[model samples]
Target: MNKPDPIPARLAALKTTPTPDLKQQWRDLFDSEPPPFNRRYLESRLAYRIQELAYGGLKPETIRRLERLGEELDGGDRSKRSVRLDRDRPITGTRLLREWQGVEQIVTVTADGFEWQGRPYKSLSAIARAITGTRWNGWVFFGLKNHRGRT
Candidate 1:
C-alpha cells in the first residue's frame, strides 16, 4: 500500500485551512454592518435592559435605577427632589366623579375630589358598600382619597 502522506504535512495543511472571518460572518448574520463600539450606546442599551428587567418584576432598587435612566433621557432635573404636599388643607369636597383609566391603582385628585373608574365604590365606602354590599375594606376607599395630611 502507498505510504500515507506525512502526518506532519497533513496537519500543517489542515491548520492553514482558510478560517472564515468572524467579523464578516457577524455582519452577514445581521444583514448590516456592525455599529462602532460606543460607550453611550452601550450605556443606553444597558439602561434599556435594566428598565425591562425592572418592569418585568425586578427589585425596587432596580426599578429606581430604570426610572432614573428614563428621567435622564427625558432631560429631567434631578436637583429638585422635593415634592410639596399641602396636607394642612383638607380634601374639602369632591370635584368630579371621574374614573381610574389605567391598570395601575391610581386615584386622580382634581380641584374637587377623587374619581376612580374601576374601583368598586362610587362615592367612596358608601358606594363601595353599595357595590360589595358590605363593609368590605374601608381603608381601600380612604387610601384612594386625598385626605388632609402629609402623604
Candidate 2:
C-alpha cells in the first residue's frame, strides 16, 4: 500500500493546537525560541514550518528572483524596502473630501496628480498651501496619511 500524506492532517491540527504546544513545536522545528507574537501567528508560522520541512522550502533560484525584485523596488536600499511608493497615491478618479476652518474642500485624484478648486495641482502640498496660505503635508491635509506619514 502507498503511504498517505501527513501534511494535511498536520496543517489542520494546527488550528486547534494549544499555544504552548505550538511554541514547543516552533522550538523543536526552528531550534529557537518563538517570537512574542499572538497565537494565530504562532499557529500559521508553525504550519508553514511543518510543511516546509516535509515538502521542502523555496528553491534557490526562486529566492534569488525574489531578492532581485526587492532590489528593484527599493533601488538597492534595504531601508527603503519598508516604504512603498504605490500606496502613497490614491487611486485615479478617487474624490477626497475634507474641511478646513469650517470650509468644505474637495479634491479629485488624477492619473498623474490632483485637481482642486477648479485648478490642476501637481502635488497635494501645493493645494494645501494655496488653501491655507501655509505649508502643509498634502497627505495629512487630505487625511490619506497621518502626521507620521503612515497611511
Which of the numbered candidates is closest to the native, going by highest TM-score? Answer: 2
> Given candidate 1, what's the lDDT at residue 77?
65
TM-score of each: 0.22, 0.53
Q: Which 10-residue window of candidate 2 scores lowest in summed lDDT? A: 80-89
Candidate 1 Cα outliers beyond 4 Å, as residue runs: 1-51, 54-108, 116-123, 136-151
* Candidate with maximal lDDT: 2
Q: Write the per-residue lDDT of candidate 2 for residues 13-109, one digit (tens) a residue.
A: 9987866788899999999987654565578788888889998999999999999999988799897656443366777898877656756688899
> Model 2, 75: alpha-carbon shift in Å?
1.0
Model 1 compared with the native: what TM-score?
Answer: 0.22
Give a tens-digit lDDT track for model 1, residues 1-151. 9986453453344333322333343344445643332222323333444344444546799889988996887667654433333332225443222212221233344444445553433345554454455773433443322343333
